[model samples]
Target: MTAFPLLDPALCFVILTTAVLAVAIRTVFAAVVSFIVFGLLMAIAWVRLGAVDVALTEAAIGAGLTGVLLLSTVARIAKHRADRGDDVPILEGPEPDPAPTDPLPGLATQSLAIVLSAAVAAALVAAVALLPVPAPGLVAEVGSRLSETGVESPVTAVLLAYRGYDTLLEIVVLLFALLGVWSLTADARWGGQPGLRHLARPDGVMAYLGRLLPPIGLLVGVYLFWIGGYRPGGAFQAGTVLAAVWLLAVMAGLVPIPKVSGIRLRLALVIGPAVFLAIGLAGYPLHGAFLGYPPAIAKVLIILIEAGLTISIATILGLLVAGAPEERPS
Candidate 1:
């Protein structure tokens, strides 16, 4: 019989605290910060569940990239309000009445939600608890075919070969999102620098750190991509790190954000998808199915595809963080 796992009391406490603060913090900025912490805690939980690939994704995209994106948006909001001569309010709902000062609005509604949440939690626990002693699994099959896929990592084999179609769609979706962000630029600000520009101040810690970090980050990012076929890293994780480095440079005002309309910038955003499509199309003549790699050069082709994807993913994510242009080009 399967045994129920004991909860880690410390992890549970941190998660609850961060989650409550994320919803309850009066200021939007504080709430967003709390939410970022919550994402990181969730990443830890994913790791504890023995899903290392999911954990990397949760850390790179969920916690790291998403946190930076939200923080940037928050800065934009604060700037927008401040520029309009508006006094920024804490902006919160009314405190719940301790005593029954009149009928408590939504009390029954809140109670129902709690009950529903508890029911869902109990159901999940029961399901896990009742899992078969020899749980059904597919690790053996994945391992057996891993060598044929020309990758040492079973996870990479699944992503690049078995589920290649799904990966292609995900890449295209990223491109579509990039197009949307670019479309939001004002006509005047079209092709202008993205996000806010920082003044050239070498004395600031941000600028100092920005200058210091990119080289190291770049090295690590490349290593992650290179080792992904045999290890825990991959295009998304590596690309996110590269994107973070680029964002840091832009945020520090050390480097200007590229214009949306720049040819090179546009190419950076689309090249991966374009290359992927080209290879997939070639499969019709060279192989029986789409995205099939010639067995002899499968590893080579996979590496090439991942390289282009890393660049494009980095570009798309960086632009997402920068957001649409609000000001016209100088």
Candidate 2:
């Protein structure tokens, strides 16, 4: 029924190939790159399935942010090994042999892993095959009451209005995650900046992009947030854009990294969840249920919540990428 019949099959083929490559590749960097490609392809698949919100989320957090995190972790590990005078090189030349203590898994262990993977795949296929035709879903119910949620976009309505509790918890999780990252800071670096200070040449390409792209990225981020009430864009995608901009600026030496313990920084990190919780609690007294928005001002309330979440999400994501505080320069 699709307009591009071959397109779907081609995409699926490529996705499967990349997934296999991601797992089979010997180099960590190559595997990570393959994984990122797979995430991007999956985002496209979501779009094809007509879930634009999910597509945006997959592209932003799944591919973009997660890829960066993995790449950074790999780099850090390589550097740590090199600093310790291990045989491993720092991201260049041939990979060193695995440490004797960390030998490859025996054939029995490999066979067990293969069996478990095949069993899980078979179970998933059986479950899908057994699903009822037209699959039971709440589409009709959601559509019937969508107007009451005050958001034209069903995705936004579900996230910020109908199931606001889950959204609030997600933001709280991000706050908690950032707290966990901060906890890794050493006593000597307890109040220091959250990331290493970059020193980029003023005339370099990175510096140029840093100075230029942030203004454009800021506009895009705001647009995505503002349109969420009526379209597919929302807080998570907007926050990711803003966070990337901040990270880019920092990496290009256009701005100094903020200290993890700063009062302003802390406020920025918690304000979204705090605002969301306060509004949800107020709903109980006003509408007789938690997260129940009264008809007249429901739109306004949703927008306010999204605004708060956008700020908090952006700050938390940026800090998460920046990581825990590092020792101050002597």
Q: Which ten residues in a row have the lowest lDDT in candidate 1?
A: 89-98
lDDT agreement of model 1 with the native: 0.83
lDDT of each: 0.83, 0.90
Model 2 clash pairs are none
Clashing pairs in 1: none
Show how many residue pairs clash in every candidate, following the order shown.
Answer: 0, 0
Could you give candidate 1's per-residue lDDT for residues 1-330 as a string of tens digits? 225345566778999999999898767778878898888888888877777878888888988888877877776766676688766532343323346576655988889999999999999999999999899888899998787878897888888778888889999999898779878877877888776566757789999999999999999999999998998888999999999999889888888788777899988888888888888888777787799888877888788888989999999998888788866777
Provide C-alpha RMSD values for all models, in order: 4.4, 2.5
Best by TM-score: 2
Model 2, range 6-37, lDDT digits (tens) per residue? 99999999999999998987778888899999
